[model samples]
Structure formats: structure tokens, C-alpha cells
Target: MVELQAATKLDAVFHALGDATRRHMLRDLAGGERSVGELAAPFEISLAAASKHIKALERAGLVRRTVAGRKHLCRLEARPLEGAHEWLGFYKQFWSGRLDILESLLRQEDAAKSQGEDHD
Candidate 1:
């Protein structure tokens, strides 16, 4: 049950990250907290569209928004990214190990071929 919940959250995180605009927003927020207008400034998007992207990040636990008078200040939450990183890290390690083994096998094959040539 807990794993399922985690997977669902990860899905949201990946979905949020899947958009280039959202990724740029995340990158901007990484510098510091920014108002919705500030976040929208770099892209040719209206405040409503920017709000929608921020909402997606919020749903994914990637960004936290706080109301300050008329301004909505958004800051990067970043904890959810840790879960995503861990999930990707597992596959990274798996692929790295597999590649290492393949390289070793290729090196051994090359050595055998060299020895055969020398003997001939």
C-alpha cells in the first residue's frame, strides 16, 4: 500500500518534470523563491498558464507556494526529487554494472584474439 502511494507520487513528479516549461520553472525556483509573475516572465505565458504549471509542481510536491498579500511566492520543495533520484539511481547502478561486465568481457576477448595472432 505504501509502495503504491509512493509510486503514485513518483508518477506525478515525473509528469510534472515531463514538461519543458515546468522544468524551466523548477530551474528558476532553484535560484530562490519567485513570484508567479517572475516565474512567468521568462516564458511567453500568461499568469493563468504559469499558475497551472505551478499547481502541477505543487501536486507533485516539487514546489511550495505561499500567499503574500497579492503575490504568490513559489519555492522549490525538492524533497520529492530525492525519491525520483533514488528510483533512477537504482537503474543507474544496474546499467553501470552491466556495462562494466560487458567491457571486461570485451577486454578478455581482445586479449584472446591477440594471443592467437601472436601464436600464428
Candidate 2:
């Protein structure tokens, strides 16, 4: 089903996002495209390690890469993140509703307690 495939793809996106290094790379790409070397500059990782991270992002559909001769140019492909955001938005709404109910109950209980103290 399409939903299953979307969930599977979202799983890959979350796995890719689970790493701080890949997240930073995505943030860098958000500004515009950059060479693999440019993406790897801030970290102490070897080029190979950076490539592995980029490959993961590519697999998640979070980044697009193009080869220009010997250089690998990478750019953010953020559409997959929109899917992830949509998935999280469902839970956000669910929790927000639950918290709102909890806040109302607490406010009612506090008002009742104050009324009892005033009567005493």
C-alpha cells in the first residue's frame, strides 16, 4: 500500500536524521549546494566517512548529488522531510489535545481548592 511505502521511506528519513553529522550536512546544504569537500570541512571525518553519511542521506531521499568530473556536488532535497513532518504533525496534534484537557482539569481542581479554603 502507499501508506506502507510512505512509512518505510519515513523510517529511512528518520534513520538518516538520527545522526548529528548528517543533520549538519543537511543544514549546510539548505543554504545552497556544496561540494562534498565543503560539507566535510567542519568535521574531522575523512572524505570516505563523509561520503558514507551523504550516501545515507541520498538513500533517504534527503539529498541529491551530482558528479562534476571528480567532484561530488550535494544539495538538499527537502521533500522527504515534509513527509516526516506530516507524520509528526499527527502526534503533535494528539498530544496538544491531551495537554489541553489536562490543563483544564488542573485549573478546575485549583479553583475548587481555593473555594474550599475561602469557606474555612
Candidate 3:
């Protein structure tokens, strides 16, 4: 089991996802475990750069790497993802309220436009 870090795991997850390459790497890892070379092939960056991104993901607890013979295989660890879910859940009410307001305003505007067109 992954021990919860001092800083919220959500912080780690978001921090790890801040980079485009890392996010892509996660997407790839979702399918199955991959070697460093397979992960690096999709990006324009060098292998070293991709390795750095993988390192960040590793620190965040979003990825796990194991040595299989000579190759390092990367696997996605979803435990930290739960932290991300918890953090996002906090904003759900706010977004829902704002969306409701916007929807009402749009409906009002549409109603007004329809009535105006009827008068013409």
C-alpha cells in the first residue's frame, strides 16, 4: 500500500500532471506497462528528458517502475489518483452553481429574443 505523503497526494498528482509529456506518458501506461524507450518514442524530446518526466511521475506515486532483467518497465499506480478525485470534488458544487446560473441566463436571453421576434 502507498503511504500518504505529508503534502496532499492531490498536490503531487497535479504537480506531476503539470507537464504535457508526463500526462501523455500516463495515457500510454494506462494501456499496459512499457519500457523507457517505448514511452519516449512519442515525444520529440530525448530519452533523458523523458526519463526525467518519468521520475517526476514516480515521485508523485502515479507510476511504478521495476527492473525486469535489463529493461525498466513503467506501470501506472492509481492510488494517488484518488487524491486528485477528492480535491476536484471540492469544486464540484461551485461549478454546478455557476453552470446553473449560466444556463438560466441563456434561457432568459433566448426567451427575450423569441418574444422580440414575435413582435416584428
Indicate which candidate wins on lDDT: 1
Which 10-residue span in candidate 3 carries the lowest summed lDDT? 1-10
Off by over 4 Å in 3: 1-6, 112-120
lDDT of 3 by residue, 1-120 (tens): 254553556677899999988999999999999999999999898878888999999989999999989898999998888878777887998899999999999999999999999999
Clashes of each: 0, 0, 0
Cα-based lDDT for every prediction: 0.98, 0.97, 0.89
Model 2 agreement with the true structure over 1-120: per-residue lDDT tens digits: 998998899999999999999999999999999999999999999999999999999999999999999999999999999998998999999999999999999999999999999999
Model 2 ranges off by over 4 Å = none
Model 1 CA deviation exceeding 4 Å by range: none
Candidate ordering by TM-score (highest first): 2, 1, 3
Of the two candidates 1 and 3, the one with more favorable lDDT, higher being better, is 1
lDDT of 1 by residue, 4-97 (tens): 9999999999999999999999999999999999999999999999999999999999999999899999999999999999999999999999
Poorest stretch of ten by lDDT in candidate 1: 78-87
State which candidate, 2 or 3, has the greater lDDT: 2
> How well does model 3 score by local distance difference test?
0.89
